[model samples]
Target: MSSNRITTLLVANRGEIARRIIRSARALGIRTVAVYSDPDARSPHVLDADLAVALGGTASADSYLRADKIIDAARRAGADAIHPGYGFLSENAEFAESCRRADILFVGPSPESMRSMGLKDQAKAIARRAGVPVLPDAEITGDDPTAWAAAACEVGFPLLVKATAGGGGKGMRRVDDLDTLVDAVAGARREAASSFGNATVFLERYLDKARHIEIQVFGDAHGSAVHLGERECSVQRRHQKVLEEAPSPVVGPELREKMGATAVSLVRELRYLGAGTVEYLLDDRTGEFFFLEMNTRLQVEHPVTEEVTGLDLVALQLRVAQGQALGIEQADVVPRGHAIEVRLYAEDPARGFLPTPGPLHLLEYPERPGLRYEVGVSAPGEVSAYYDPMMAKIIARADSREEAAAALASALDATRIHGLVTNRSFLAALLRDPDFLSGATCTDFLDHHQNLLDPAPATPTVVHLAAGLAASVSRRRAANPATGFAAPGFRTLAAEMLMSAVWQPVGREPIPVAYRLAAPSGDTELVLDLDGTRHRFDLIDLGADTVRVRYDGVDYPCAVATHRDGSIWINDATSQSGWVPEPRLPDRTVLAASAAGPVSEVPGTVVAVLISEGDTVAAGQKLVVLEAMKMEHPALAGADGVVQKINVSVGQYVDAQTELVTIGAEGEA
Candidate 1:
C-alpha cells in the first residue's frame, strides 16, 4: 500500500458502479464520500458512503454533469479525491483539469491523455501515427453532401455514418448501398446533433461480421503500464453491449499477445494513467484488427477483467493517481481462468427492449461464490424512469470458459426477480444460443435477429400459470401456524380448504382462479395438484383468521383476508403484504386497454400517432414513431386490423409500451 495515496475519496456517480468503488475504497481502509442528485439521494451509493451530500438536481445535465457542484461537494466533505465512475464527467478532460487545479486527485487518466484519446477521429490519427492499424474514416461536416458522398465511396458500401461524439450506440447508421448513403448521412448527423450536441458525421468501413473485442490497460505516473488481456463484448443490442466475457472465445494466445501489446503500447506512448479500456474491431475471418477508441475511464464490464486477473482496478487507479508507479511489471499480470458478465436490465425484451420502471416487489439473486450480482435495487426499491434501466451485472467465474458459461447460466436460472419486467430471461437465452456459445457474434447480432433476443408474444401462458400455481401453493403453505388447529376430531363442521384466486392474462382481462381444497385429517395430508406439480401441504392452523401453510420445503404464514367475487386476497406469510389472486380469465383483452404494444424500435420519444380508431391500416404503414434514447421505432401494423384505439399522442415518453394504435381483426367489435 502506498502511503501517499488519497485517504478519503468522493465518488461523483451513482448506482452500482458508485457502490462498487465505495466498497473497494472501504476495504482499503479509505473513507468514502458520495455526491448525488435529488433522485439518487436514497440511492445505494449514497447509503454506502461515509458521507453523502445532495447536489440537488433531477436530470443528469443538471446534476451529475455539474462539475462545480461535484467539486463543491467533495471540498465540503473533505474528500481528497473524486472517482468519476464511468459516465458523466468520467471522460471530461476539463473536469480532470479542474480537479487538478483544485488540488483534488481525480481517479482517472490525466487531462492530457483524455484529450488525446477522447475524440474518435483524433484517436484514430494518434493510433495511425503510433504505427497501429486503424480503420479508415472521413471528415465530418454539418453541411457537406458531396464530401459525404465521396467519403462514402472511399469507404465503400456497407459503411458506417457515425457521430464523432457518439456513445451508447447513438447517432450511428449503417448504409449497405449507395442509394441510402445520403439519407443515412443526414439521419446520422441529425441524431448525433440532437444526442451529443455534435452533429458532425464521419464515415468508416462497416465490418458487418466483426468481433467487438477490447483490451484492458492500466498506467501510472512513473511510466509503467500493463495489459490485462481482452474481453469479448460482441453480444450487443442496438450497439449497446448486453453480455461480456474475459479471454475472448476467438482470441487465442498469439492474438491476445498482439492485441495486448498494442494496447499497452498506446497507453504507454500517451503516458496514460489509471484504468482505461482500448476497444478494437477484430476481423474474425482475417484475424486482422483495428483500433476502435480508448475509453478513458473504468468500464462497466471491469468485473470480468478483475475476475480473470485477480487485480483490484479501483485500488490501482487510486495508487496511480497518487503518483505511484504501476509497481508490477508486464510479466507479473497474467490472465487466469474465465469470467463472464451479463447485464440485468429493467427492460421488457418481448416488447422491443423498452424500459420497465416500477417498484421491485420481489428480488432474489443467487449468493454462491464465483457468481456475483452488482445491483442497487432491492426488494421494495424503485426502478425509476429517470435513470438507466440496468438493474445489475451478474458475473460468474470458473477455471474454463465452459464452466464459467455454465455457472452464469445456472446462476441466472436460480435467480427470481419479480415486480418489474427484466432482461434476465433474454440474457439467459442469448448465452445459451448456439451462435453465441460458439463465439459467432457481432455488433449487428441483435439487428439481424431481434426476434431471438426479444421473444414475441411474451412468455407462454402455460409457464406463467405454472409459476403462479407454485407461488400460490408456496404462499398457502406459509400461512399455516406452528400449532395445530382448534377444531376437534368429533366436530361436524370440519375445517374447509379455502382458495381465493385471481387471474392475470396476457393481452387479456383479469380472471379468477378456482380450486377446491380438503383440510388434513389425522393421517392423510392436504395435497394440491396443479400444473403437473404435486404439493403436500403442512397446515398449522393458528387461532383467529390466520393459518400457516408449508409447501416446497418453505413455510408461509397467511392471514385469511377478504374474499369477494370469487377472488381471495391473502396476507402473504413471508412479506406480511397482501397477495392478490392470480388472474385466470382466458381472454379479457387487456392489451388494448392497458396500452400495451410496441411503440418504437429505436430510442426516441413518440412524436405523433398517424392512425385513428376504426381506421383500417395496412401492415407496413407507419402508425406511430417514437423518439428517445437516441433512436426511433416506427410502429407498424403487424397484421391487417381495424384500428381499435390509439393510446398515445405526439411528444410522449414511449420506450416499449406506448401503444400508438390497437388493431383488431376484421369484424371484431
Candidate 2:
C-alpha cells in the first residue's frame, strides 16, 4: 500500500454503506469524500467523511444515481477515485465509463465487463458459453402472445417470466400452466417497464426449493482473478434477502471449490476487473446448481463474506481499480469459521414488512465478543420513508455454523432499539429456529414457518420491562419541583393521591393500569405496587423531567410527560409515581322500559349500512357492517327495532358507540 497511490477516495453513496466504505479507506490512511443529497446534508455519513459535497436533490435519480453530479462532486472534493458502495449507481456501467472519461478512477469492474454481466439474460448466456450450468430459458422480445406462449411452453410449464432489467423480485412471476402464461408475461413486462424502464422479458425454469448461493470474486487489470468463497442468501421475503451467511449451509469444500472455480472462470472470460458476485441456485435435494445472476458491484450481504474471509472487499476494489495485480491466489483464500449477518430493518414483519419510520430515541448494541455491528444512524436520528428501511447490519462470527447461530441469537437478544420499530426480534427468531440451524431452509422458509418469524403476543416481556423502567425514570424527574412542575408538587400533607395512567404500547391498546408509588425524599424508597406485586426502582436525576432509572441493575430508556392524568409512557422500564387509583366495579342497573331505542354498541367506520330508512328488520338481524382496523364486524338489531332513520351511510367514518340507524319495537317495524 502506497500513500501516493491511494491518498483520496470518494464514496458515491450514503447511509451505512457509505460510512462503511469510508471506514475501510481511513483504516488504510486514505482520505474519504462523502457525497450527500439535500435531505442528507447533516447525515452521519456526511459528518464522518474527511470532506463532503452536496449532490443537490433528495431523490436517488437526482442525487446518487446522477453520474455527472457524482463525478463533479468527487472532482471538486479533490478525490482521485470514486467507490460506488452498492445500490443506486453501483451497477450502472455508463456511470463507470463517465468516471473513467473524467480521469477519476472508479473502484469497481471495467464498464464493458459490467455491461456484459449486469444483464441477467446476457450474463446467463456468457455463463453458458464459459461452461457454467445455467437455468433453461429463452429471451423473449415483442408482445406477440402466441410466440411468447410457445416460448414459455418450451421452457416448461413451471417456468419464470422475468423482466430482463429486474432485480429484487420485482417483475418476476411464476407460471405453472400455459393458460396463464400470457397474463404472467404481460404483468411481468408491465412491472419491468415501471421499475426498470425495460419491458423486454426472458424465461427460465423456476426451482421450488432452490437455495440462493453466490461466490465472491475479485479481479485485477493484470489478467488475474480469484474467488473468495460463497454466501448463503436463501432467507428472503418478496425476493429480497433478509438474512445472509457465508460458507453456504449446503456448500462444503467440494461444492465451494466447484462454485468458486466456475465464478472465476466466468469473470475471467468476461474480462471482469474489481469485485463482483456470481449468484447461483443450488437444488437442495439433488445437489444440482444453475447460474442465477451476476451482481456487477458489491452486494448488500458483502459483510458476511468479509467476516468469513477476513478481507476488506472495498480496499481490494480500490487497489484493483488502480491497476494492481491480484495479491493472493485462489488457494490462499480459504474461508474459515462461519459468519451470519442479520439486516435490522425499520420495517414490521408482522404487518407484511411495512416500513416503520420514526425517530430513533434509543439505540444500543451489546459489547459482546464475536459480534460486529454496522449502524448508519444513532439515537434521536430519524428513519424517514424516503429511503431503504435498513436500520443496521448485525453480524456475528464463530468457529462453527452452530456457534455462529448461537452467537447471532445472543447478539440480537442484547440489541435494544426504541422510538422506531425494528425487526431485531424477528431476525433473532430466525437465527434461533431449528430449521435454520440445521440448514433446512429454502426460499419458502419464512412462508412455511410464518408463526416463528412473526410472534403475535406483542412485545417481549423483557422489552416491556425495559420500556417500563425507562418510563419510571421519566416520572421521577417530573416529581421534583426543581426538575419540573409537571408532576404534582410534593405534597407533605397528602400521603398518596388517587390517580390512573394509560399507556399505549405499539400504538394499539390503552391498558388502564393503576399503580401506587411512594413519595421519594432520599430515605423513602419508590416502590411500584402493581396488582399486589412490589417492584423497587432506583432513579438517577438527569434534570428537567428527565431521570435515568435502573431496575434489576439495568438502565431503562424513558421519557417524561408534560401534563397529569397518568399519561406518561416509558419505553422499556418500570417506573414509580405518586398516583394510586383504587379499582371499583362499574355500577350495574336494570332499566325498566316499554319500547326499545336503536343504538350502535361499538363505534367504527360503516363499511355498509345493510338497512335503509323504513326498511323492515327482525330481532337479532344484521343491520350494518362496520370495519375497524382492517377487520370487519357486524352490527345486529336489538329487540326487533326498525330502521326509522339512517343516521350513517356506507364508507362514513364514525366514532365508538356512534348510532348508525334508529330502530323501534316489533310493532313499529
Candidate 3:
C-alpha cells in the first residue's frame, strides 16, 4: 500500500470543480493530475494540471465514472491519491473500495460511510437514528405497480418520486395529480436507472414552499466532527440551484445552532472522514426543518460557505484524508459576513433554458473587490452537451447582504460572454428583484416570480435607436480596424451622416432602424429618427469590447462585442440588448401566441403523446410531453383544431423546433 500522504493527486472530475480543486492543491505544492473525455481534450482543466490522462470516450459514463479507467490513470500517472472532486463517482462506494484495493488513497469518507449515506432511504433511517428530523416518506416495494399505487395514496398528492440515490435534480419527478402518477413513476425510474444505475425509488411528501438549507459538516479519522454553518439554496430553476448564499437570510442564531448540532451529530455518528453537506427542507411558516438527504461529497456551492467562513474547504478535505486531525474546534469556527453566489450556465433563457452547445468566442468577467470567479472555460472553448452546461460560479462577499447583492449585480453588468446565449440576464434580474431583496425566496421562487426573469421589452423608440447607434459604432470599427475613419457612417466634417441598419433579435423578426450621425465639435453625436421622434445621444467606443453611450440624459455602460459574422451584441447589468445588420429576406406574418405553429423549444425524447389524429382539442390542451435534461415540458395546443398528425413517437429524441404534432382546421384535408 502507498503512504497516507498525498504527493500527486488525480482529480477525477471536470470543469469548474476540477479547476477549483487544482487551485487548492496547487497552494499546497501538490502535483495535480487531470483526466479528460474526448470532448474535453482542450479544456482548461487539462492545461492547468501537471499531467493529464485521456480516459477515453466523450460522455461522463465512459470516462469520469469509469472506476477502472480512473484508477488506471492514477496508477499511470504514479499518483498517490485520487480526489473525486464532487460529481462523477465522488460518492460511489464501489469506486472508493476500488481505489483502496488498488493501493491508492481516496480523499473522502470510508466506503462504509459512503454506502450508508449514498441512498436517501437508508440515509433517512440513519438520520432518524441520530435523532434528526426527517420527512414522512414511504419506500416502494419491488417494481410492482400495485405497491406504488398504494404508496402513492398513502403519501398523498403533490409528492415527489425520488431515486433512492439522487442528487442535482436528476432521477426525480413531481406528481401533482393522480392521472399523472403512473407516467411520473415510469419517467423517474428511467432517469434513475440511467443516471445512478439504481432504479429503486420512494415516495416523499413534497412541501409546497420551503427553503433549502444545508449545513456543512466535516469529520476526521479520529471521529471528531464540527459544523460550519448554514447555506440558503432555495433559489432554483428546474429543481437545480441557481443562486446560493451563506448564513441564510432567515436563519437566526438559535436555528443555526440547532441545524448545525444535528448535522454534526450525523457526521460523528457516521465517522465521516471529509467534507459533506447535510441538506434539509425548512418550512418557512413554522421554522421546522426536515432532513432531505446527506451528500457524502463536497457541494457545488461550497465556495459561498468558504467566503463567509474564510476557510479553504478542499484544502481541509485533503488534510483530513491524510489522517490529520481537524485543526480547529467548533468554537474556533466563525462566519464573518454574507456571501452570495450565482451559477452562470450556457443556456438560452428565452428558449426555455435550452443548452446552447457552441464555442465561447469571448468570455470576460468582472474584476472587483469581494468578487471571486470560479470558472470552467475561458475564451475560445466549446461548451459541449455531454455534461452539465454550467460555465462558471460568480461569488460576492460583503459586510451586509444588500451590499453583496449590489456589488455582484454590478460585476455581472461588466462581464461579457458571447458566441452562445446564457442566463446572465436572468441572474442580473434576480439580484434586482424586490421580492428576492426582501428575503421572500423559497423553492418555487422562480416558478412564482417569472416576470423578473424576463428581459425588458426590446421595442419602443429609444431601444430601437440605441440598437441602431450601437450597430453603427460596431460597423465602423469593423471597417477601419485602425481608426474610426474610412467607415461608411463616419463623417470627416460636421455634417449629418444618414445611416440605416436592420437588427434581428433571436426568435423574432428583423427590425429596421434608421438614424443620423455627425462628428460636430470633435464629439460624436447621433440623432435617432424614431418615426419623427428625434432623440439625440452621444456615442463613445471604449476599446476592448466596451461602449459608453449617453441616452435620455443617462449614461449606459454596455459591454459590446462583434461576432465573426459582423453581428453586434450588447449587454448591461440588468438587460442584454443586441443588434445586427438585418438580412434582406422574405417577410412573413407573425402568428398570435395562441397559434399552433410554434415548434418545440428544446431537444428531448417524446415521452408521451396526449392527443390522437383527427381529435378536436382546445387551444390550451396538452398535445405532447417532451423530456429534456430530466425535466418535462408539454407542448400545448396553441389553437382549437383537429389533430392532423403526430410526427414523433415515444422514446424518439427530437431536436429544438422539430414539429412534434401538426394541427389543422376540422375537415380541412
Q: Rate the local accuracy (lDDT) of all candidates.
A: 0.72, 0.72, 0.82
**Candidate 3 at residue 199, lDDT?**
83
Better of 1 and 2 by TM-score: 1
Q: Write one digit per residue (lDDT tens) for candidate 1, span 1-669.
A: 224478899999988999999998999889999888887778778889999999997667678889999999988998888999987789889999998888888889889989898778888898887767998788766576677787778888788877777766777888888788887786677667655667776888888879999999998877788898899999887678888999898898889889988898898789888899999999977999999889999999999999998988988888788787878887877889999999998877777677767666556766998898888766657776666778899999999887888788777766656555678767766766677777778767777666565543223232233333433453454455632342311123335443545555322245454433443465213444444344465556532345555555655555443233223223341121222355443232454334433444333466557777888877677787655433555677766778887877765665444456767778888
- In angstroms, the error of model 2 at 232 is 0.7
Best by lDDT: 3
Q: Kindly provide the TM-score of model 2 when superposed on the true structure, using C-alpha atoms.
A: 0.75
**Candidate 2 global lDDT:** 0.72
Model 1 scores a C-alpha lDDT of 0.72
Candidate 2: segments with Cα more than 4 A from true spot: 1-4, 144-148, 175-191, 456-502, 507-669
Residue by residue across 401-425, what tens digits does model 2's lDDT show? 9999888877776565666457776
Error of 1 at 348 (Å): 2.0
Please rank every candidate by TM-score, starting with the best.
Answer: 3, 1, 2
TM-scores for candidates 1 onward, in order? 0.78, 0.75, 0.87
Worst 10 residues of 1 by lDDT: 483-492
RMSD after CA superposition, every candidate: 6.8, 10.0, 4.2
